[model samples]
Target: MLKKLILIALFSCSAHALDSNIIEIMQYLQRDSDLIQRGFFLNKFDIVQEGIEKHKVDFNTLQKFNIDMFLDEKHINYSPIISSFLRNIKENRIALEKFLKDNDKIRAYEAFQQLDYNCMKCHALVRGW
Candidate 1:
């Protein structure tokens, strides 16, 4: 009985820690996304680069958590979809980097739009919308 109680306590604490990490990652994502958009609109390469770097770190940190925690009951089995979202995000990030490096604003903007699309799609899926 004592062992079971300790295990239960550990599980609860682990879940709480995962939730906290997810929330912090989402906050970082929002901040970096805003910075990226603002930089693109203002034609500030430095800001965009900074945002992209930070966003990359955020994604890496996010991958360390159990993604199912982000989903509602209706979408609990949608881990594959969430994984695809991550792939799309990675593709867009690479494209954005290449375009920005080449000084191609138009292509960078398009990649950014795709990145935004993936983010919204993932959010909708998780929220069961």
Candidate 2:
């Protein structure tokens, strides 16, 4: 809450200009991703595989939250872009799952790289970069 308040103050945003759910979701993903990346580097395929499923579920939850949060066009913000990004994340998660299940380390690395790229792209879009 203090972080949100600080962000609001820093950005000089209106009361409804911020979405707390998005911040929470991003933090969740960040932590999950750090684990997955660390696990991958340590050759802990099982850990990465498990974390991918969790991230998929979290991504889906975030999508549903966005749908509910932006159901009214009046409160639209950049939800359409966010929803699209979330869908991409879900798809990438599934591909990563399949890659790990197949024991294709090379492909799994590539998929994870793409997922990371998508994360950066979505962040840039959200921040109006």
Q: Clash pairs of candidate 1? A: none
List the candidates' TM-scores in order: 0.93, 0.71
Question: Whole-model lDDT for model 2 versus the true structure?
Answer: 0.73
Worst 10 residues of 1 by lDDT: 65-74
Give me candidate 2's TM-score against the actual structure.
Answer: 0.71
Per-residue lDDT of model 2, residues 18-53, tens digit only: 466667777888877877898799999878866786
* Candidate 1: tens digits of C-alpha lDDT, residues 5-124: 999999999888888888889999989999999998898889999999999999889888778776767788899989999999989999999998898899999999999899999989
- Using TM-score, give the best candidate's number: 1
* Model 2 pairs whose backbones collide: none
